[model samples]
Target chain A: MVDGSARISQDPEPRKNNRVHPVLKLLYKKRWAYYFIAPATILFCIFTVIPVIRSFILAFQEFRLMGNVWVGLENFKYVLTDPVFHRAMRNTAFYTVVMVPQGVLKALILASILRNLPEAVQTFFRGAYYLPGVASAVVISMVWKWIYDPNFGLFNFILGTFGFGPYPWLTSPKTSLTSIMLMGILTAPGYYIILYLAAMKKIPRELYEVADIDGATPFAKWWNVTLPLLKPTTLYITITSIIGSFQIFTSAYVMTQGGPGYSTMTVVYLIYNTAFRDFEFGLASAQAIVLAAIIVFISVYNFRVFSTDVQY
Target chain B: MRRACWVLVLVLLIGSLAVSFGSIGAASKWTGTIQVWDFPRPAAAEEWELQAFKEFEELHPGVKIEYTKLTWAGGNEKLDVSVAAGQPPDICGSGLRLPYILQGALEPIDDFLTAEDLKDFHEETLNAVKLNGKYWAWPWYNTLYVMYLNADLFNERGVPLPENGEWTWDEFLSAMQKLTFDRDGDGKIDVYGFGFTFQPTYLQPFGFIYAEGGRVLDIDKNEFILDSPEAVVGIQRLCDMVWKHKCALPGAGGLTTTDVNNAFLNTRSIAAFVDTTGIISSFEAHNEKVEKGEIEGEKINLVTAQYPRGKNGQPIAAGPGVGSWAVFKQKDDAKREVVMELAKFITRGEGQKEVVPLIGVFPSCKSAGNVWAGNKNLEHIVPAVEYAVYPPMHPNWNKIDEKIMRELQLAVLNEKTIDAALKEAKRQIERLLEY
Candidate 1:
């Protein structure tokens, strides 16, 4: 890193503006770069940053068509006591807890297997695995809804062929959350696989060869060399999967509508229902802020745990 | 130069002549667009809407109408966002409840109509859209829930049907239990006596509650009385039908209105179901299929009956599914006038005749009823108009409805006791009322 900085310092063309103020000279030198990024920065601020800030403000106010009024802690009080909110939080936690580790482990295994395959075969399988991720969540939910239909779904039909009776895959409360979790585990691991595969490729072949020279088995080499080196990638995948699972909404909404008695209700789905369906924007914003805080806390904790000795 | 100027004048004159000749009756004095957000209807069902738009646009040449069709699935959410962002459409054709909930955001249309013109609408239909003795919207048609019975199943089981299209809840329960049986003696019940989803429409339990003289809100006192004895009785009956009797098909807790409708209409697995008058179209199509030898079973003889009477002995009163065209409070008076003009045009004689039939709803206009007189389906719902109950009007009624429905679902699913569910619902509704 120091040698790279020294090489850039030796570039004579960039050092010619020594008379101007240092900050001004630096700004001038990067003017075209700033200009190139201005559109994206402006768009991000307008769409994302503004709404996020506004939501934080809204969390402390009451929304009305005529005007908004400040109502600090009131919305949070209501949300905290809300029975549906409690159910949503519990359901969301269950989904995240069950889905994240399952997704990360599945992706890691698949990526490890793909790493040993021929380049062409790896590419083919990578595309195949990533294909479903390209489909919109709504579309995927709709297709899964059909597959989970109690009477005439593909799952029930296959079950019937084995002399077992039809099963209500999504309709029954006992199975609804499990069915949705299965979908989350399936849909979430594809992108993680690609990331893990890229990270695996970056690991030096010398490490594995050193293990091989030490008379290690293939599994031992993978465990002692490849797995240890993939720590940063694994941490990234786990944190992201946890966040994604916590926001499970589309499947529950499109398929069950948080129904069979709110068995599949997640925090994000509850937020949508409270905000849009019930027209309680302040309460919704408070719920979202609480959710964001919970996510941040969990993610930070995960970073401390999984990222303790991450090399690279 | 004089010759060239004369040639240009000749060209201009020809162009003027062409414009005047081509746009004979297409002259429109009004200019600007009227944005509309409407609940999604089948594209084929909007033939009259399309025709009216064409006629309106032709007569008002410079005027443009930008129509947005919103699906019922997420339509209320879309409207909530639009209204929150202060960009609601110039006109909306949603239910009576939503526009009323929007309060000052809607323009009262009483000023746009004369007493003589207003008298053309059914009083019950008008009452649904009126708040503070002023009309917020002009009605297009009325939708009411009525029981559709399978006469074949009733006769086959030798179970007597409701007399005079009316029966008490006791009689209704007795009939349903008798109608349910194990065919082929296989010990599995092949036929369900009734089918209905527990979705929170003001169709079933609310209808039953109203029949018993109980209500969700006392408009005068502004209090939620959902846990009243009469309301509890109505909800208990519904819950018992699922949890205790099991007369309905199992897993009805998850069925949509369409799912139940299909089970009753096409599959014949369900003996009866209560739904909107629009199910007449499905019944007619089924009858057509039977005539064409496409279906081999004994023909389904569909009969429309009144919803069962509650303890007070009055027939169930369904909330009027009044499809109303509400005008938003626009800044421009000219735009408001155009919106009112278009609304009046649609609710009146010729326009009403064209639209009401496609909608499969009973006409709101007294004169428009004549256009559907010969139709049997329209005749069935005509009696329901008198029995149509207006839902409690409040700006927070939608939220109240959601809470009530969610709790009712929990009760029906055995997630909560009937008393617990209704109590929680009442608490939530009271809190909303306080707001």
Candidate 2:
């Protein structure tokens, strides 16, 4: 069998001694493919990979004015016992629980509705929904801050019309976290909706037609065809949303400043305060690593649940 | 593929060329370009810089001043990064916080000033700029916290003002109770007697600890004395004002400078503990409303007094005033000479006379105070300045203040008992001192 395979390979390239080998020729023919791929890979390495590796190295060391000293596990130990770190972890967990499912489900529902609309109407709605994603986070946070102002906000004005008392949306410890989470939910979900809509549109019409011929009802067809086809997009969105939720910082930092007594202090905000405010770069790096590990674990779990060899 | 590589190369070449051009452009002689980093004041950076530069340019023609404005919130970090990067501005204005000086981030100006130049500034004001036996910064403006009362509220309640800018704790509480009222006749109270803030400096009246002759930190021993009897009494008095007397608002622990100022401006509260600078602006902004029949009681009369005297019978107020100036060491010799000259010019009697009114910042020089001696608007600041006690001058003051203030907030908000909070603060401060 080896002799026969070798003879077959030799027969296909009889004049190879005078020129480049066929394999080399094939690779050279596809040189543009490699060229096209190089830019994104280089960018990804520089921007994402390098920083990530640097952050990992920084986690085990003590950063001081003079130089960094390697004190393995010391920073991690400090992070575990630090009250501020604990508070940050608790706040981030609470925020994730409140924000992630709500964002994902709302996007899914909106995408489903949009999918049934006329093509032009769907396009307009998609663009309108995705507009907030294009806005600067600082501007969005500021606008939301004004809207949630207790003294003369639009929210308070609306409540006043209904004979309800004004709520301290961003001030009171009781309502501040929820109010910010609501902003997060509203500002996000739009991009995910657009993604899901595109994914749904890509589902072959023949699948639904076949289901219909098999006497599948609208709901049945959607359950058997549309939902299954959208699983990969849903998985992607879920992992991203989880990671995004874990790193929620700008809104809380700008609006409430983790105040009314640490009610809105997310893990990333704490990391920022530790590194920049207190200049405890080592502790901040450790906290960041812990955060990253949690994200990786959740992503892996999501992949296991969503992607499998047993395809429907 | 070849075209793409060429494009990438061209882009990189252009980037490098642009960078080189920028470096060459910046390499030019000073040519009147005075780089300045100013923190947020009511006056815009450009407006203030232009005014100062225009005057300087007239004196020394063919020079331009470049000004960069930094926000107060992150100004220190930005300044630190610039210094670390070895590209700090020729001049920087910062709060008279000690860490910057201790860290050698600022230049010492002792060599620049002669004995005669030094003699013009108040000794205490001079002390504020000194760190480790060297003058690290020049004192530009000073402000002290003072109690401002709404005269209309005091008159209506028949509560007499302090006899001589001094009142005991009991008398202060009695006045606060009488002033606090439910205007709508509802069971719930709409107005608070005192708009007390839970800031570190606001706790100054409890200066009984220092008056009782207790130190904030034993610099020699490097330990905190915050849990001392004097500190306990001061802290207890603050808590009593909130929980027992009910004179202070419940959310006073979280009150911001803007919130307290708003309360005073909107007539939502009777009294406010604020800085002299804020009072100046408040009066200026509402002077017309006071003249008209707009504010309640047909003419709002605002009066200032010293913080209520502690039980020791000696009135003590926390006077932590921050000054701005140009440091000589931070700049090259030529830049240093110019900065020193500019500093002298600005802090001179003439500069003070020109800038103080526009900025509303009190002058650091005694001569400048004389300029505003008879002005009614600036009259309130005079008494506060006279008796203002400076906060402890330590390199770690920022850390100390943050820990102390956090504890004070907890104690005031009843989140922690006074003893526990004070102990925790002392422990934290001790840790800070070691660093």
Candidate 3:
């Protein structure tokens, strides 16, 4: 073996070059990776990026059935002065303020409970909770419309059993937004719960065992070891929930129709009505851009609020 | 061998193409699909439409008809979006509102209709479909507001019905008050005196406004004058019915016309309500149920009455509702003609006569009206047609209607003062008109 190695080492080595283009070299190295991601990248460009750019352009154009004309800032001026747009923004803000935190907290608590259960029971509860998450929002909204009917509603019926008089749920302006928010908090937390549980399961088991050996209570172990470790997951769920709550439209559309004096109006609902109902696509596009800005601002604010430097 | 095979394949391709083209060229028949959309009609009328389409297909062997029935609730929005996308139906049954015509999506029927066909239609009905001095749609049927009285409830309460289908506003108010009472000695009222929806499309209140000689949009001035004194009084009376007198249901702001109709026919919880003549069939069915002892209430002698005369002593009625077949701009002249023919056939032929009794809508064609003339069920329909006010024809009335209805609802709910609501609505409408 020594003699063969000595002979192989005596042979001349191949030359290496440093003259290849960096981009071409990179392409050669990661060709398989690029090939795998190409389809998804092309789809995103076509469906998401291109439409977004077009919507921005459309915000400054007066769109007609025959043609579109450039009318810079006119649509923005209309949106700024429109009272309905203001009301829509306020309603969306109210919904985000109430629903996002409630959803996150409920999801976190349920996920904490789910993590401690036996594996078999945990699977059952997770499936049960996630069932509603799989349902279409429109179908859920239609069911909720019946549940909010003043004459015969499940909520009023339950309240009536306790000797309270019937209360108008979706019919009254006073309760319409709250009713929609309540539906959101109750039905949608399941998605976050699954996410949180998956994150919780990833925590090192040794940390919990060490906390137990140090005479830590279950709650103390969760607080001291689990929560800080789950910071990234919390931040993600919080950001997504806030963005989702800001875009709330289906319930307002299917159940209330932004009615009872526009109490349940959401920004997206207004955009839809402006574009399709009023045939003001330019103003609708401006409204959509404003909504996107709001979602971006809120998402950044959430990251600043909840993001923490914690590592295992 | 390979060269021979290539030549053989080329020959076969050319031969097949020639055969297909030759067959198509040999036929002299017109061939294409005509798309037709209509606002939702009753099952009977829908059957009539299907039968008529079959007949049309048979008359023209190569022509095909694709029909889509749309609900009134969100049909207009769907139609608007489709038209905006430049894929409008070749023909559709719509109200022929000014906004649709102003969009230049409709084809004027001016050149298509012969003088005889034009003469066959009611002149006023024909005028209803006109904009910019051109006929944009073929009038099919028309519906106007009529007061539907639950006669059994009135009789049980000893409330005198409107004499000769006429009443003054004071008498109407008095009747509404007399008709309201609590049963079972409970403080809670089970039966409301009047059934009126706050829904915008259910423009029963427009009749009242018209009765007052008040107009909403000043078409000449191109401004909304909803805050005018007469209009204010008209809206105030409607609000008073819901809030001050509590004659309407507590949930009036949320109830749709369908809900009001249900309360009248099935629940028998309302004494009287104003609606279009389309409710006659539903009312008749309720009476049949009562006669058969299927329901607990006594048989109702459903009667139609005129809207109460206003301070002007005029019983003017208006509906923002009309039924007409509109022709869209089709690129091909032949297809356009085919669509117009289909529209004419539906509006003037057997289809027109078949839908009147089923839906209780008055036909726009005088000859079609003759089919149900002297029919006891439609006795009030023809009389009510005389009072039908053509809704304001401004291009922006759709948005104006929504704003007025929303603010009017706010006033009715006591969330804002009626004056404030009207002023705000007028401001909103002004902004829209400016746009």
Once fitted onto the true fold, the runs of candidate 3 whose alpha carbons sit more than 4 angstroms away are: A1-46, A117-124, A135-168, A185-188, A308-312, B1-92, B95-100, B107-127, B132-135, B145-171, B256-306, B309-316, B328-360, B365-371, B374-377
lDDT string, candidate 2, B1-435, tens digits: 999999999999999999999877655524457777778766543366568767876665456667788887778777767665656677776633454554555677887788876877766577667655777777776655666777778887788987645676678778888877887783446567777555534443344344444456655466687777866776677678778988875555545445566666674564545455555666755777667746643345766666666655665555556566755244457566777666666567567666666666556766775555666545544544534455656766755775676566667767779788778887766656765
Evaluate candidate 2 and give its CAPRI docking class based on DockQ: incorrect
Each prediction's Cα RMSD? 9.8, 13.8, 11.6
List the lowest-lDDT window of 10 residues for candidate 3 chain B: B377-386
Error of 3 at A186 (Å): 5.2
Using DockQ as the measure, the top candidate is 3
TM-score of chain A of 1: 0.90
What clash pairs does model 1 have? B28-B60, B28-B61
**lDDT score at residue B6, model 2, on the 0-100 scale:** 100
Ranking by lDDT: 3, 1, 2
Give the CA lDDT, 0 to 100, for residue A161 in model 3: 76
Chain B structural similarity (TM-score) per candidate: 0.75, 0.74, 0.75
DockQ for the candidates, in order: 0.19, 0.07, 0.23
